[model samples]
Target: MIILAATPIGNLGDASRRLVEALANAEVIAAEDTRTASSLLRALGVDNRPRMIALHEHNEVERAAELVELAREQDVLVLTDAGMPAISDPGFPLVQAAAAADVTVTAIPGPSAVLTALALSGLPTDRFTFEGFVPRKSRVPALSKLAREERTMVFFESPHRIAESLDDMATAFGGDRPAAVCRELTKLHEEIRRGPLAELAEWATGGVRGEIVVVVGGAAAASLDLPTAIAQVLALVEGGARLKEAATEVADATGLGRRELYEGALKERGR
Candidate 1:
């Protein structure tokens, strides 16, 4: 059997009893970081030392079949440095392999940074999307597409890129869009800042540290008329945005169809 266990994101006390038992009894442990896995065992004071193997992104694909085969014979434990495995982390490949081989896979649920940040974000959690990390390139266009997203959006970002990411989000989603920046969650210096995207960008410029989770409130339902949306798109095109890009941006913000907006802009251009 393959056991997917969740480790504490930060607080050690968050470790569940089932995770500890699994760690104590598993024959083979496939960890994202062997050093971290060893440390976790020490932290939990587990006496049974299992054979530990590294199963990180660089090697997970190659090692997945081997690990799944081991699980078929005995319990093989999967873990990450923090949070559940395969959540924007290593472990998915192994899980997929296990499923393909008809190996039983089960999870020992515990702490999660995604859920932690969302709960503390003060945003509408009823509907939310978890986008693990923001891409380094073409981030502007990516965020531009979600400018009109009504469901709250959650994202993980490194400290170095948080400021730039926030700035781009503000530009794409509007400066006044509501957002929260969660830092070092469940740690000593944990902080949660709630404000408009513009304000968060300004704050980030000063400096940021620790693991970061950003939650942005989605765009409200569009109330503008089709003529108004088309006009908006035309204005964007006049300002040098491509017709397609202009239509997409306007349509996102106004809940209009990009095709209709583009056609309307073309008609207006002909006038």
Candidate 2:
């Protein structure tokens, strides 16, 4: 069996009993950072240390196969530096390999930065999407992809790039889109800044510290004027986005007025 364990994001007390037992009993532990895993176990007073092997982005492919081989003989536990494995971490490939090999896979669910941030974001949690981390350089495309995301969006961003990211989000989603910048979540200086994307961009200019989770409210579900809707749809289309996607982006940016954009696009496309 292959067990995917969730580790604490910040507070050590967040670690669950199942996670503790998994850490203690597993024959081998594939950890993103062996040192951190050791520290966590030590903090929890867990003495039985499993053989720890580093399995991060560079080594995950090779290590995953080895772990799967071990799983054929004994239980193997996969963990990340923080949060659940495979979530913007180096566990998806291993999970995929295990699934293909018919290995019994399970998760000892515990602390999750994504869920914690989303819950505290004061945004619509009923329908939300986790985008992990955005590309460091290919930001335009990244923002374009998110422009059409109807559900509330959650993102993990570094302190340094927070301002730039918010600016790009403002450009893609509209400057007035409501959002929250959650900083140092679950820690002593935890703070949540809620406002429009433009305001958040301005706020982040002075610098932000600690781990950052950004949650943006979905576009309002209302209609827009025909000219405004057409202009937005044309901009997206000119940026290489498809008509359907462009329509969605324009609608989300301008509120429920997507039908007008769709119709305008049809006429423009001569369809």
Candidate 3:
């Protein structure tokens, strides 16, 4: 069996009893960083020293098969530096390999920076999406794709680029889009800055620090007549989106019936 364990994002006290027990008894561990895993064990006062395999983004693809074979013989504990493995971290390939090998895979649920930030974000949590880390470059194009996203969006970002990211978000999502920047979550200097994307962008100009999670509220429904909505759908379709996808996108934003928009676009295209 392969066990995926979640570590504390910031606060040590957030580490669950199950995680501690797993670390204490783990025989072979697949860790994103063996050194960090060792530090966590030492901090948790887990005396048992497990054999740590360095499983990181660079080597995970090559190491996954080897780890899967070993898991057939012994329980392998997977850990990232923080949070759960395979969550925008290493371990996805390992899990895929394990699933293909019919090896039993399970997880010990615990703290997550994404959920923590979202819960504290004060945005509509009923519907949300975790978009992982923002692209270092091409952010405008990347974020433009989500311009009409109707679910609260969550993202991880480095402090150095937070300002640029927020600015780009303002451009893509509008300066007045409500957002929350959760910094150094659950840590000593934990800060949750909430305001419009433009304001946050300005605040970040002076520099921000530590682990950051940005949550932006979803787009409000736009008021548009069917003809206008259909034209937008056709534009997206011309830009390489599938007809159905384009219709759905526009429909979601304009609160139009998807089938009606799709049929109208099809009729307009046939004209």
Candidate 4:
């Protein structure tokens, strides 16, 4: 059997009793960082010494088979530095390997950064998606694809990139899109800043620190009428956005035709 465990994201006190007990009795543990695992055991006051193996993004693929084989004999507890193993962390491949080998896999669910951020975001939580982290190089293109997504979105990001990321998001989804920036959640200096994407992006320019989670509200459900949409295109053009680019933006958000928006705006401009 393979046991996937959830570690506290920030507050150590959030560690569940089941997690503590599992660590106390675990014979073998595959941890994202063995040193961090050791530190966790020490912090939790677990006296039992479990054999630990390193399993992270760099080596999880090759290590999965070995860990899966060990699970056939006894339960192998899986852990990451914080949050659940296999989330944005390094446990999915191992779990997949175990599944392919027909080994039983179970989880000791507890704290999750994704869930914590979403619940605290004040956005519609009934439907949502966890997008792990935004790409470093292809950020805009990647986020632009999600511009029309109706489900609330959650993404993890580093402090250094938060400002640029939020700015790019504003450009993709429009500055008025609702969003929340969660920083250092469950920690001493935790903050939840909720507002329009433009406002948040501007505030982030001052600099941000610590673990970050961004929650963006889904696109509005109804598409605007063509005339209204075209007017929006013209308005954007008036604000210095290229006519074609402005039309494309409105078309994407309002489910209209890019050509129609561009032509309509052009005719209106001529009139």
TM-score, per-candidate, Cα-based:
0.86, 0.84, 0.84, 0.87
- As for candidate 1, its clashing pairs are none
The ten-residue window of minimal lDDT in model 3 covers: 223-232
For model 3, the stretches where C-alpha displacement exceeds 4 angstroms are 223-271
Go through the candidates in order and give the C-alpha RMSD of each one to the true structure.
4.4, 4.6, 5.7, 4.8
- Alpha carbon lDDT of residue 258, candidate 2? 66
lDDT of 2 at 76: 83
Model 4, total clashes = 0
lDDT ranking of the models:
3, 4, 1, 2
Question: What stretches of model 4 exceed 4 Å from their correct place?
Answer: 224-253, 261-271
lDDT of candidate 2 at residue 26, scale 0 to 100? 72
Error of 2 at 66 (Å): 1.3
For lDDT, the strongest prediction is: 3
Tell me the tens digit of each residue's lDDT in model 4 across 38-133. Answer: 999999889989999999999999999999999999999999999989888999999899899999999999988889999999999999999989
lDDT for each of the candidates?
Answer: 0.87, 0.83, 0.90, 0.89
Query: Model 2, 1-271: lDDT tens per residue?
Result: 8888998888888889998887778768889999988888899998886898899999998877888888999888888988999999999999999999998889999888889888998889999998889668756555655665679999999999999999877766777889999987778888999999999999999999999999998866554456545655765676678988888776765565567778887887684
lDDT of 1: 0.87
